[model samples]
Target: MERQRMSTSEELMHLPWWMVLLEGIAALIIGVLLLTSPGMTTLVLTQVLGFYWLIVGVLALVNLFVDHSLWGWKLCSGILGILAGLVIIRHPLWSTLFIPALVVLVLAVQSLIQGGIKIFEAFRGGGFGAVILGILNILLGVVLLSAPLMAAFVLPLVVGIFALIGGVAAIFGAFRLHNSALRASIQQTPT
Candidate 1:
């Protein structure tokens, strides 16, 4: 007999339900922390980022010895990463302000790019919805770019709100997955 192939979602749903439940719980806790103590929590996470960048930078430079194909790019990235890591680590308070603002700027740039793509698609016959979306994206991008530092201050609260919603949804999805699996198992079992 040929084995049946599972759909992507079916395969994903087969993940142990307990794992999803645990993830939900963790996300919920993080959301609460972020909302309650946005500054402290963000600071702690930024510290972790500092450590990660430092390690990755060191590794990149060391990797140069093993692979010399892109020496220039690797060297440049390694040095930049190292400097960024060191600066962030040395000045925690500054990093908390600078990092978020930098990220907002990047997001603004991304929004602009995406908006341009949407408009291009609209011209190629994607309809008015795409054009409207494109316009909104451009507007938002401009707004963000105009006040990245101000947006940075609100970033944590926004993230916290998203986390809380995601956590709650994940918790519900986990239970649904568990029930679905239980029903599937029951159907498969021989009497």
Candidate 2:
């Protein structure tokens, strides 16, 4: 049987709007909790990350059979993620020491790369805001790299703010999906 590929928007349209709304609400709640209790949030976040990675790994592995293209890289990535997640979940105490270090290092590298891209975009006629954001990203990357341990402590606060923004975006997305579905249904109804 041939597999039918759906466009991103079409796939999204098929999704139940209530599911999106629930996801947004859940993110909002988690964001609020993280912001309110940073210390506890870090541990919780670590555990959640582990579970996320594990689930993603499993999904990716499954997808390897579904989509054979780039299967090698997908398999490797899935296995690595699964192993890392399992190790972290099985040994929370040991994970606490190394996970934070790893997280900060990854964040530092991502910030640096993003900063560079933004700076380049700014030079290519992007707004002043881009330049400012680029500078801030570079500065943050440097600071995080300098004291990664400290950066780990601050990670929860930053993550909370980002999560809040994401939650808001998801809520808006859910409404948009709902409206589109309503319109589609109305159009399909007999006059």
Candidate 3:
């Protein structure tokens, strides 16, 4: 029996296109703002980072009590996120300069782990796309980590680039979905 291919919708359900585009657009906007106001960028970045960390931490904390299986990991992540959030709040200036570097470090570590898992999963009959995505993620993380200080200066630009790519991907996916739906409806009509 031939393995069934996943439809565009099915793939996109797990990776929504509009959300990707929105995220990209938001980053692009932020990048533009940062470029126009370099002096204020640090404060803006700090506030954004702090809020983000705080929200994620709160969500993780909630998850810890809501799910028993992931209690340990959730709780740990929650605590760490909260602590990081507080630090950012307390030292916005420092956070603005250092948060990007921290992000790069964390992403680099996470990408390696995620890529390894993807490679292993692919070996065990997962999709080739997963492996490819994993490799790309790892490469991106490595690039971020290689020159974190320099990357920090260009963080907004990097984020904008990522977002733009993601947005384009989302738009393409959306069009694919539109075409598929059109085709399916036409096929279902009486000849």
Strongest candidate by lDDT: 1
The deviation in Å at residue 176 for candidate 2 is 3.0
Error of 3 at 65 (Å): 4.0
What does candidate 2's lDDT look like per residue over 122-177, in tens digits?
99999899999999999989998999988877777787888899898999999999
- Over 125-156, each residue of candidate 1 has an lDDT whose tens digit, in order, gives 99999999999899989999999988998898
Full-model lDDT, candidate 1: 0.89
Which model is ahead, 2 or 3, in terms of lDDT? 2
Give the TM-scores of the predictions, in the order they appear. Answer: 0.83, 0.68, 0.57
lDDT of 3 by residue, 22-74 (tens): 65566556656666665476578788779889899999999877887878888
How well does candidate 2 score on lDDT at residue 77?
86
Worst 10 residues of 2 by lDDT: 1-10
Candidate 2: where is the Cα deviation over 4 Å? 1-10, 51-82, 113-136
